[model samples]
Target: MPLLKVLRPTLPILVGASIMLTLGMGLRQSLGIFLQPLTRDIGISVSDFTLAVAVQNLAWGFLQPMAGALTVRYGFRPVMMIGSVFNVIGLALMAMAHGLTSIIIGGGILIGIALACTASAIAMSVSARAVPATVRSTVLGMVSAAGSLGSLLAAPIGQVLSEDYGWRAGLAGFVVLSILMIPAAWYAGRVDRVPLPKTSGDEIGNTSAGVAVKAAFSNASFLVMTCAYMVCGMQLVFLTTHLPSYLAICGMDPMLSAQTLGVIGGFNVLGSLFFGWAGGRWNKLMLLGMIYVSRSLILAWYFMLPPTPASTLLFGALMGFLWLGVGPLVAGAVAEMFGLRWQAMIQGLAFMSHQLGSFLGAYGGGLIYDALGSYTMAWRIGVALGLAFGIIQIAFALIRPLSPPPVLKAA
Candidate 1:
């Protein structure tokens, strides 16, 4: 069937999913723009601020499985709608923050909880459930590509507002953008009505969540992918949380950081589309390994060179292309490896590892920077670990192809 023909009926659901994802992720990713000003104005150190971000990742990581499980019990609407409200409250708290306590509560805890309900894992699940398997990967890429637009818009807007008005004003702008998520989540919640497809393995969807968890853990391929996902989280979070400070420390123009992030968002569109398409036809895990390897190489290249506008923007483009491409591949792989019924919960298991790495990236980079007055050690460690794991991921994926999805004994 033609792509449009397949999507036309479900257009509203996909669009809502995309918008919810875009705003949720874009705003979160762009939060790094406020780090310097927020910390300075609040009389906190860089590490203190990043500690909140690290906490956010930890909260988001740990809570994701619970949220996914809730979606199974209640529905995506209630989970996502409540998250949208949390997003508003969180951003409002960040805007009015007087101290680290407020920042951690609003930005760290609230936003983290919001993300559990609203971001990539849930968004991809919604998209996967709404579309047919034949074009599932391709559609996931499209949704992810749309999601990339958030950072592109959010970064520039927040930066301009912060530069002219103040950091509070920038967060306020984000709050306004976040309000749109409520309705998006509602529309996206419609997926709850879409029945799971009956297939030979339809019984897989009927398994208890506990049974599903056991099955997922027993799969070796799933385990390797989960481990490798940690490295992915580490590298990406380090950049989002630290890249601005790195550029500023180099005496580059302040706007340059936002611009670089925007460039990343723009290029992310192309990368997401390409990877999404590529995933359907190729081995998804191998593609993931390749993205990791490419990202590490790119990180090494950019960090090694002296700062320049052209170099920074080019670096953003390269990195952006590799960025959210992970969304489609990971989500699609999980759905294929398991089944859609528990897809969100299972994927959340892997994301917990990713978020652990994110915690390390955000907080760890700040610690290194505060101690050494440079990102030299941080980037080196990131590059080294990324390469090692990327290679391992590739090798394991090739040697041990994914076994068939687990089958529970007759009850």
Candidate 2:
């Protein structure tokens, strides 16, 4: 009752955004489950398949700013509706594909574009506009947690479908689920009707989107945060894309890999919530620094320990707790610094940098494994990058409060 009472004002936006994230991110997270099966069926190397998936990440990042601009101008519903169509079509194409070309076109290009529209950037942007500033971080966290729930549920479900019927059927089933996002998109579009408060003279409200972009690009803190997000993207995609394969390579049961992903998803739910609450109450940049530092330490411990079911589960649980927790904090920081007038566009650019990292992590893991016959090099690189980024984040914490940019008048 207390929770409901607190959320009642923004419940629709929260529910709609959560559902959209659930289907959008859930399906994306489940792609790892398809790695072995799809490759086996198509007779392609893991590197090839990974390259396609990497393309998907790149495309997602490439299109993010466009999607944000569209959402800002036309509202979220139409963008979501079109995105749902792209997802359904893309999944169907992936199901029918017999070669890497088709897979890249379907899974990489179309689905990548679809995710740009349906993913957290749009969800957070709309939710930020709909909710009061006081509770924005919490709502963003709730939405992210919902997406994690999708990640949790999708792995096992995809495994079951792939194991029972076939991987193709599994993709088809996801197509059905993706269609559900259309309605959710419609519901989330209602945020456009909820008027946002006008910004004070000091805010960037009077400036053009071009000016806001220039200001964010010029801000040292924003630049640092964007760079830090690159590490987040790389680490996240590497784990999501390769964890199952890594477990299989270690001679663990395939099912355990799926379960590990599910575990991560489960823990991510709590992690996102906790980080969300903490972001509101404490220094968010410091929280990010700690998260990266913890990730480096966790990976070290995981490598040191023997690969077993218990170790794998523990790793997943710990990693899951850190998963996606940065999202709300990053979005909240952007809102705090820049205001919401161009929040979507600015955040979209930051996320684009994240996707660049995703591109490297996802594709590079496969390339390394193919070349070296193990993921050792890739994991080691992640550890080093995590530590370096962690320190960089802490340094950012020392920066003074950002001064708002000059407001350029619109023609």
Candidate 3:
């Protein structure tokens, strides 16, 4: 009854938001499948191709807050619709690209802007505002799970398209699929019109955008959360951008590599949902700490064990389950601490930190491999950072939430 009550009002918005997230994140995750083909065809080195993806990650971070601010000002509809258009354009350009410049322009700049508009940060912000506080984490987690679903479906489709028809055709197919987000964007924006509950302190209705942003940045919990989120981005991007190639180097079949990624996506659905539910009842910070610790352990075990199909799938499943599990908890914590007044903007700032990590992870993996002629060092670095971030999050659990800032008086 409680779940039904929460779902009644928010279901439509959640579905719409999830669809947008699914398309955006799904396409992004499938990019790893293209690396070898794209590089071989373009006659560029792996490092050069990955640099463009790294630039895309940087551009996404740089533009996220700006996109969030725009969504705050103009509402989610226009921002998401415009972003969907950019997605089509970006994919189309990438399909036609033959050089680094075009790849950077299309994949890095355009698609980066598109992701800022359409990714989980914006979706979670909208969902947080639409749902009752009781079900907020569940809704956020479900949206994250939906994104994993996208990756699950897209991975195989992308692999098939790329292998059979060339990477260009695969990208073009994504362009067609991206058009569906236009209507979802329109429906998702409708939630913005929903009235906010009147609550004391920093409820969505009580605070202005400027005040909320200021308060969020000034809060120690948010800053620590943002730092930990950066590590999440690093791990995620590095794996998504390079995992297939890494598997290839380890003597795995290409099809098996794609299948492994798909398996990761599949398991992530359960992981996100479980973490989302757990976030409601458990210590969110501790849960985040565990997720990072799990990642480090998984990576360590992966390298320690022999590289084989069964072992690879097991690793993929473990990693997938932990992959985006941190997302809902982080978003839920932000909403709990800051309220939903400018949730999109504040969450965007946190996601910007994530994207910054993504830039380094995606680009740095390529750089390390190019110089060292192996990805072993990069994997080692991921293990170290994961352990460090896990400790940082546990330390953060000791800090109390900051008191809300004083409301300014009129002259």
Candidate 4:
């Protein structure tokens, strides 16, 4: 099995997508490390910072479908290149911010839009288009695994720099990293040159975006998956946005948050590989349900106990193993349902649901903490919602297995 021979043609695209994904997601996820310093220095509340993050998610979600559709009209290269530039500008603004308006514009609006073009959805779509269907899921998993390394590197670098210098310096460090996205996006744009693979007559590969979106919304399984995806966003974003503050409240060292994030990134590689492989063999929606269930249980267990280095690290490892695995599963499932032509857009539609949940997780958690001065209520709600959604996802998957929606030829 000469894997290299098979992948050689598309290797550059995959590599570029992976690097873009790593830095884009990594740097964004690590922003929580700056919350304390940024808020205190700017004389803003925790809720303010979280609000910007929430807006970022909202912007990312709302613009994703548009970005994906543009990829269909234009090529991925141009859309992604523009996004890479946005990432640079956004980070630069954050690094120089003296007020909330700047943070909202840079961190919330621009970076949010940047992610629409550079993060998981776009990255996964690039990989899917670059490879054969036979190996698409595995390759998606591999790329996702590789992309997970960004947080591992970003967290420690930002945390160290911020601790020694200032929050702005940490963001400046991220700006340097984001510049690399320009070249990565250019290379990944090469996938635009690879003609879309042929699909069955029944698949909606040639449908207009309007028609395809209608068909996607009409499907029951996709709807269920999209709803469950919201819970996924809620749970994951809550952690990334608030976990450092939680640790700080617990009197843990600031460095622990970065280390924990690094651990999660390390484990993301394994989770992506495992779930990517599992998705090809098992039911993707069911796998998603199980991951959510496991995450809720872990959340319950971790937050219930006092924070220790060992326990915190363990939580990071466990949680990390479950993180980003969704990239391959969701991406693969979208491709299976809609075909590659609109996979990015359809996935973006689902991601809109996920981002709505992210808005809740990031902002809602902050609001609760501000009011109560404890995260007890927030985590409780998250766990309850996660368990309910996970069960629903698993049950719905078992009852109504996924099938592609009908596509009518353009009249």
TM-score to true structure, per model: 0.98, 0.95, 0.95, 0.98
Candidate 1 C-alpha lDDT tens digits along 158-229: 999999999999999999999999999999999999987643334568878898888888888889899999
How would you encode candidate 4's per-residue C-alpha lDDT over 1-411 as one tens digit per residue?
676789998999999999999999999999999999999998889999999999999999999999999999998999899999999999999999999999999999999999999999999999999998778788899999999999999999999999999889999999999999999999999999998995432258766888889988888889999999999999999999999999999999999999999999999999999998898888999999999999999999999989899999999999999999999999999888778898889999999999999999999999999999999999999999999999999999899776677553331
Best by lDDT: 4
Native-to-model Cα distance after best TM-score fit, residue 383 in candidate 1, in Å: 0.3
- True-structure RMSD for candidate 4: 1.4
lDDT of 3 by residue, 1-411 (tens): 978776887778888998998888888888888899999998888888788888888888878878878876788888988988898888888889988888888888998989989887788888888887878888788888987887787888888888899988888888888888888888888887987643223454455677677777777777877888888888889989998898888888888778988999899899999999999888788789889988988998887766899999998899999988887998888777766766677788888889888988899999999999988888898889989988888877766542333331210
| Steric clashes per prediction | 0, 0, 0, 0
TM-score-better candidate, 1 vs 3: 1
Q: What C-alpha lDDT, on a 0 to 100 scale, does residue 206 get in candidate 3?
A: 57
RMSD of 3: 2.2
Q: Which candidate would rank higher by lDDT, 1 or 2?
A: 1
TM-score of 2: 0.95
| Candidate 2 local lDDT, residue 188 | 85
